[model samples]
Target: MRKLDKNLTETLRKTKYFLLDLDGTLYLENKPIGDMKNTLKFLRDKGKKLIYLTNNSSKGAHTYVEKLKNIGFYEEGDLVYSSGVATIEYLNRYYKGKSVCLLGTESYRQEMINGGINVVDGDRADVAVLSYDTELSYEKLCNFVRAIHFGATYIATHPDVNCPAEDVYLPDAGSFIKMIETALGYTPKVVIGKPNNIMGENLKAKFSENDDFSFMMVGDRLYTDIAFGKNCNFPTMLVLSGETTEDMIPSAEKQPDFILESFNDVKNYF
Candidate 1:
């Protein structure tokens, strides 16, 4: 095996779970980046768990699973964990039994229901969850805003303003949050996704028995991915294959513990 710098090698060795961002981190749109399949397989071959973590809640985990598997990035034991799933974890633990008004895609709504959450229309909601609601409509927005005005606790799934695409960027959950703020002059009380600890807490719980398990967050976005690792108290690795470039590193507020040209490049340091 090729040996890396002491710290990088140690971080790689110690990390039992790698929380990976999907869009810009691993692949672009529908294709894997630079032998990504081989790199991930090498990690798993060494017994490292790969968790395809994403902030987009517009789709369910199965959707991502299908995408990853089709692209050959997925293996039998690998997992896809999304902000929507993490939000469900948060709701069950903190607001269990509460009527939740969700401004999200129908698939995500089903995910919440499957997690034992009581999904209600915004009019009757005791809590409102804002996710990447690709199915968002005027009626849904009005109801979600009204629920918050009526004292429903507001929570956002993530803070990403835009999502990367093969061509153009699309508005994400954070854009919706900003819209709500513009309309209601209020924001969510808690954001459940990246740069937050809820997802990290869920991971901790999932791997609780293994106290030796350390986490590492790898991605392309500095604010979301690197910041999340910092929030989760995990080592962070920034990859250049996505949104961020080498020039953007110096001015970034969230500096990663390691940097690489692309995620597949980790094999060099191993």
Candidate 2:
């Protein structure tokens, strides 16, 4: 795999669409990389379509848009596809207005509401949806477990264990899933996010079929980002500015098509 540098410009020039990871690949914590806005503008100026693809289901698409705007990467009509949005889409298609018991943040709840799904209280729900909740507590866990034990359909937005932060990684929806599994003796029936068919279908619907399209997946995590690319037959680039560290390379289950220290470093290759 080649390191991202100025020589990769030809490759970038050839790309027609960019599916970007929000947390690690675009920003670290709440801070955007120095050249991030410019890089996005550069891609757009070259006629490439851009979409923000994030596994953090705690927030909705509009929330992501606001966050990006706050960080100065303002773009109109830019699509923000979160795992939460995908989960909503999945439920709408399959369950069709079923009562759901959700274990997620306020934003997630709002997204479910906006998506026309019903969020009910207690174990009587037809389905139990799990997403990243920053305010996760024992009480909420108890309620979710009860719902799961009562045979409610289990669904997870993503299987991300932890989310990258400026100082430390925060437990994601997958971590809570593990806890519930250990206690209930079962895992979620479905996980809709990166590396899943649901996300692929959503993306494919947005971009028309292209036999000659060269796709690339760029992100920081090996499991989610790189695995998604590898599973979907797209080239992957892993940046070291987020979760994957130098020492973890040998043990990585999936390898990236390219590796770079950061997005800026990759610019040199382009």
Candidate 3:
């Protein structure tokens, strides 16, 4: 593993946009990591643009904004972006206000509604958006199967199987998606989240004109967060705070540009 160094600070100082992960890199179990708020303030004070990159489609961007605000991160609306937002954007572009049925949390439904798309409760939808709904039920699965069988377009917010918390890992929306896929005999038409270009494209568009811009994706997951950055040809920082650990380094097919214990240690690189 590559250690954090002063050279990393120079590289970060040159970065115009900082793509950050929420769950593992900045917080754990709804609590901000040590010095995370201070670090964010420091970046903002330096006039560096920061965007919260998350694969957790269980909640919308507004929900995240509220959560962050409650936790003492005073961010404006544009600073937060979620997979839920990406899904809405995709649906709006292709379907153009089609009647959609969503198997997601309340926050996801709200996001769909905010995007001016109708959210049908049953299988009568024109398209079905599968997101991470922690309150998933067998009845909902039955409805999702029916919708897919009826030729409604199938979409997933993200393909994450599990999400890490402070206590233990929990079943993410992708696990439920697999169940529906097994019954339907095929996967969704598209998944809008990390390791995909949709989120990256949104980030790039938000921070346009990047002549001197460098990006570093800081997260704890190898497959999702790190892969997203590497796939986009951006530098990656793997912090040992949540899902990833030191022992898992050798098995990883892709490596990060730097590795630190947590966000607190990242300040040293600055």
Whole-model lDDT values for every prediction: 0.87, 0.79, 0.81
Model 1 agreement with the true structure over 81-184: per-residue lDDT tens digits? 99999999889889989999999999999988989999996476789999999998999988888888888899999898998776888999999999888877
The backbone clash count of each candidate, in order, is 1, 9, 0
The TM-scores, one per candidate, come to 0.95, 0.88, 0.90
Better of 1 and 3 by lDDT: 1
Ranking of candidates on TM-score, top first: 1, 3, 2
Candidate 3 per-residue lDDT over residues 56-141, each given as its tens digit:
88877877788888887656532787898888887887899699988888877887898888898879889988899987888887
Give per-residue lDDT, candidate 3, residue 247.
94
Q: What lDDT is reached at residue 227 by model 3?
A: 83
Error of model 3, residue 63, in angstroms = 1.7
State the lDDT at 71 in candidate 2: 95
Number of residue pairs clashing in candidate 3, backbone atoms closer than 3 angstroms, sequence gap of 3 or more or interchain: 0
Best by lDDT: 1
**Model 2, range 1-270, lDDT digits (tens) per residue?**
343355356666666656778777888777886688887886677677777888988777888888889998759857788889989988988999799999988878988998999999877788999889887878888888788888889999999888777688788888988988887687999999987757766666557645323556788888888888777766677888877898987788888867877765654554
